[model samples]
Target: MRPRFRRRNVASEGTESLGPSIPDGLWSKCPRCRELIYTREFERNHSVCPRCGYHARLTARQRIALIVDPESFVEWDAGLSPADPLQFVALGEPYPRKVAEAQERSGEREALVTGAATILGVPVGLAVAEFGFLGASMGSVFGEKFARAAERAAVEDRAFIVFASSGGARMHEGVFSLFQLPKTIVAVESLSERRLPFITVLVDPCYGGVTASFATVADLILAEPGAMIGFAGPRVIEQVTRQKLPAGFQSAEFLLQHGMIDAIVPRPRLREELAHYIRLLTNQHSASPVSFVTRQESDR
Candidate 1:
C-alpha cells in the first residue's frame, strides 16, 4: 500500500486572506537583490535597486531629465531616422518593420538623442543613447547624430557629454553600420584638435562598435555602478578564447579597478559628477589649476 498524500490547493486554501494580491504595476523586482520594491520609490531613486544598489537602465528621455536642468534640454537631430540601405530582412521580419516597432516602443526617432543642455547650470552638448530602441545599436543615423553633437559642442565652445547605453553596431544596416566607427572617431578627433572637452557616461550593457569608437575617445569616461562595459561580452570572450573570466568581468567596478574608466558613479550622483568634471576640464566656475592637472593625469 502506497502512502496517501493530500495535494494542497493554493487557491482553495484561503489564500485570498493574504490581503489581496499585489497590483502588478505598483511594485518592481530588483534583478540583483531579488527584492520587491515600490515602483515609485525605485523611480525616485533614479531606478537603482535600494536593497543591493543595482543601477537600472534608463531611457534616453529619462536620462536626459535626470542629468539636465529643468526644461534645459533642446534636442538635436530629432528628425533623422535610420534607413534600410540594404533593404534588410531578418527572421521573416522586414528591417523597416523592426525599426517601426522600436520607434513605437521607445517613443524616439532613433536610438541616440543629441542635444544641448545645462547640467547643474553648466552648458554642454549632450548625446544620450536609448537602449529601449533596438538595444541602442549604432547605425548611420546614430553616427550622424553623434558627429553633429560633437560639432555642436565645438561650435558652442562647450564640453560634449554622451550617455552610451548600447549593445553594439546595428547589423541590420550591413556594412554601413561598421562605417560609423571611423566617422564618429573623426568627429571626436575634431573636438580633440579644438582642445574641447568630451565626456562619456558608459551605461549598463555598452558594447561593440560604440565602445570601440567615440564612446571611449572622450577625455572623461564615466560609468554607472555595476554597468557592463566591454567590446565583447564575457560569454563570447570566454568561448572564443577558451578561458575562464575573472569575477566581475567587464563590470564598472572591474573597469574602474583596471583604470579603464574615470569613475563608477551611482545614478543619483551622475549629474553632479559630470558637472564637476566638465567644469574642471573646461576651467569653468573657477576650477583650480591643481584640479585641471589631476584631470589631465587621469586622462593619460
Candidate 2:
C-alpha cells in the first residue's frame, strides 16, 4: 500500500497566498455596452472592449512599442528633471517627490519621452506622453523636450511624430507649465518652416492645453479608435453648460465626423498606416527612377 499522504496547507507554508482572485469576467464595466469583461481580454484587443468598442487608456511605453519599429527607439532628454518651482505640497507630499514617484513607476524622467527612431525604415522624431505621470500634464520639462524633438527633426531633415495623451497643463507647476503651450507651438512652427512632415497621433483622453497646441498643429492628425480628443472633459463641459452631454461626445469618432481628426486608425493598422503616410509625405518614392516616371505620367 502506498504510504499515507499528508496534505499541507500551502497558505500556512507560505507557498501560496490565499485570497479571492478576480474572476476572468470581472475586470471592467464597459461604459457603452454596460458589460463587464476580463482585463486580459481587454488588453488582448489593445484595450478595446470586445463588446462595446470602448477604448482603454494606454501607457507611453506601450504606445511607443506599438507604433514604432521594433527595437528602433532611442530616447532623448532622459536626464532632464522637473523642478518644484512652486514648492507645492499636497496630501503631505511635495510636488518634486510626486514627480520622482512617477518617474519610478513609469521609468521615464518626464511625462513626455522624445526620441529619434526609424519606423518602417523611415527616420523620424517621436514623442510619447506618459499618462502615468501626473496625467501626462505638460510641465516645463515636457515643453522643453517637445521643442528639442521638433528642433532635432528639423535639423536632421526628418519627420516628427507626437502621441498626445494628457489631462492638461500641470497644475502643480502653475503658469510655468501653461507657458509650454506656446513654446511647443513655436517649435512645431519651426518644423513647418523647414517643411518637415509632422504627424500627431491622438490617444485616449487627450485634452486641454495639449489639444489646443502641438496636438492641433500636426500636418497629419491620426486618432486611435474611440479615443477622447477635446479641449475640456465631458463632465466639466456638462457642468458649465448645465446640460447633459451627448453620448460619444469628444470621442475620436465624433471628432473625425466633425473634421477634427484626419483619420480614426485602429491600433493594429496604425503602424502601417503611419509608415505609409510618412513615406508619402517625405516623397520616399521620389528617390526611385520608377517614381519619376509615375510622376511624369501623372503630370501628363
Best by TM-score: 1
Candidate 1 local Cα displacement, residue 21, angstroms: 9.1
For candidate 2, the lDDT comes to 0.83
Question: Which portions of model 1 show Cα errors greater than 4 Å?
Answer: 1-23, 286-300
Query: Where does candidate 1 have its weakest 10-residue lDDT segment?
Result: 1-10
lDDT of 2 at 202: 93
- Model 2 residue runs over 4 Å out of place are 1-52, 286-300
lDDT of each: 0.85, 0.83
Which has the greatest lDDT?
Answer: 1
lDDT of 1 by residue, 46-161 (tens): 88878889787778898899889999999888999989999998889999999999999889989999999998888889999988899999999999999999988888877899
Model 1: lDDT of residue 277: 84
Global CA lDDT computed for model 1: 0.85
